[model samples]
Target chain A: MSFDGLWPYIYIAIAGWLATDLWRWAGVVAGNRIDERSEVLNWVRAVATALVAAVIAKLIVFPTGTLEASPLWLRLGAVAFGGLCFFIGGRFRQIAGIAAAIAFLAAGLALLGV
Target chain B: MTAPPESQSQSHWFLLGMRGIFSLPAIILMLSFVGFAAFTAEAKVPVEQVMFMTGMVWALPAKVILVGSMLSGAHIATAFLAVTLSSVRMMPMVAALIPEIRDRRTPTWLLLIVSHFVAITAWVFAMEKVRDVPRGGRVAFFAGFGVTLTLTNIVLVGLVYGAVSEFPPIVSGCLFFLTPVYFLTSIWISARHRVIYWALGIGLALGTIFAVVAPEYDILLAGVVGGTAAWWGERALRRREAAR
Candidate 1:
């Protein structure tokens, strides 16, 4: 909130900006050499998706802050609920899945008296 | 992926890209931001920094990692390294995506500039829809969606940041869940190969184990190992099928 406070924000901004964008820059550099349909390209796609999957899994399994308040089973339950709705919900599958995940999380939380 | 038509005007492509804001993914992504705002407020981080991170960093995962590390009292350098490793997945993704949308004449600088906006949501959105967009217009269309999504969420987070204190912890938790769930389902649905399933499963299992072993590097290690294993595993399966 003051002049002294501004340093952390500046450091965070720099770290956040560079940390995220570094990969984008790297992707463009690496992208130029990759044959679009090659096995290597498929590997790249696999790696990206897998990494994101890892991140999601980590979050769900060992969350920080408020999400850490809920039990891991309850968290996975919500995701499973969402996944189920996603498959069967037809045209608005994403909406159903997301809405279901939230609703399930809320219900689980309520049941635990949180 | 069809025949390339004559280039449309830049504005046309831009608006077409902006139109994605109303789509299911974008709506869910926005809700994800609403959760971030709420989550950060509860953790007592500066609202201005969170907003700055939303616009400047522009990736929810990176922002979350930054705040999560700070809350846990991590060294700044460790947080930076963790965030960088997390974003490394962008390499294969942007590589896979940019070639699909750019023409030979598309400028490198423009591609570099706009590529900053090509996070997971925008990448999936563009990959699904850009097949029909003419080659000349694909960049604009991608930019329209990516840039607009960033700006929209930045503003959305800013607006919600101040009001998040009133929200219950459960509400914020559920709101935050939207982004990851959206990412999970959309990526699984849009995956180009069956081998991706292998990667997803391995990544999840290994990620949980690695979380306790080396929390800072868990995502990077699990992803690389899992993905490489999937590729090799699928290849062996194919060879066995051929032999049979």
Candidate 2:
């Protein structure tokens, strides 16, 4: 591959590594120094939690690839069903919720013959 | 708080951690990685590249953001920023998790290395279980769990890459949904603060609106605006409660 072709991987290596690893290194340095209950840390936690929530929201609302083929209503219904199963499954809710969502999507697709 | 009992042996604790990862949590993790594998395949990313991303990045959200951004012909710097922003959550996770397994005697280098494995799966597990492990055994336990997860993800991604061609379209489509569903549910189960609830509600609303308004920067926009709103709302509520 040309250097142009290889640029993405290089970017992935440097940028990707820094993005995730910086936090890890910082956490190590700050291990016990920063109290978990501190205002700054709590704010950081809120932002981080919000970021992940935004990611999930973006995926559901503005998905790419095959997921884009399904109608918005179907996707929302799937998530709702999955969240319900998550609450009901008790112990292994992650798997249960995901399974329910996929099953709901499959059944919906089949019914519509999509 | 009282000290936990001394571990039977570090090796025994390590083994316990290794065994502990074989349960539902690990299964969910494996399935999610499998979904990622299928996603990369559909995106036409090379298998070797996918493996490299998994090993190095290790965070699914960052990986997804990187792959999606690059494929859309985004500049390298822009892609990097998106990935980094998406991954900022790991800072708090690593910060929170390391203390549970750390003691003064624990080497800084070791903590740094172990921190690499502190993804959501390992972090949640370590936070809940490490308290029961002896202080000296905590590192070993986390190492065992983290290492197993890393290796398993690497292997699972490779297998799924090779196998994606055989799966029917619906199956692969469903697999692609697994990662997002897993993340949302994990967040739901782990949410302990009212701020988290506000953030989720606001993020969903803003993210949905922004996706149509500005597709390229929706995640970042929603995160900053929704997160800040939630933080302020939480503080206001706390102040009112204290005044009462």
Assess each model's interface with DockQ, reporting 2 decimals per model.
Answer: 0.62, 0.53
Clash counts per candidate, in order, are 0, 0
The candidate scoring highest on lDDT is 1
lDDT of 1 by residue, B69-169 (tens): 77887776887887887787777778878778778887778888988998778987887788878878889999999988999998888888888778877
Worst 10 residues of 1 chain A by lDDT: A1-10
lDDT of 2 by residue, B63-171 (tens): 8888887688787778778887666667666765666687778888888888888776777567557778888899999998888888888988988797865566576
User: Model 1, range A7-81, lDDT digits (tens) per residue?
Assistant: 667667666888888889888877777776788877777776678788888778877667887888899999999
Pairs that clash in candidate 2? none
After superposition, candidate 2 runs with Cα above 4 Å error? A1-12, A30-32, A88-96, B1-9, B42-45, B68-79, B99-101, B127-137, B210-221
lDDT accuracy of residue B59 in candidate 1: 75
lDDT of each: 0.80, 0.76
Interface RMSD of 2: 3.3
TM-score between model 2 and native: 0.81
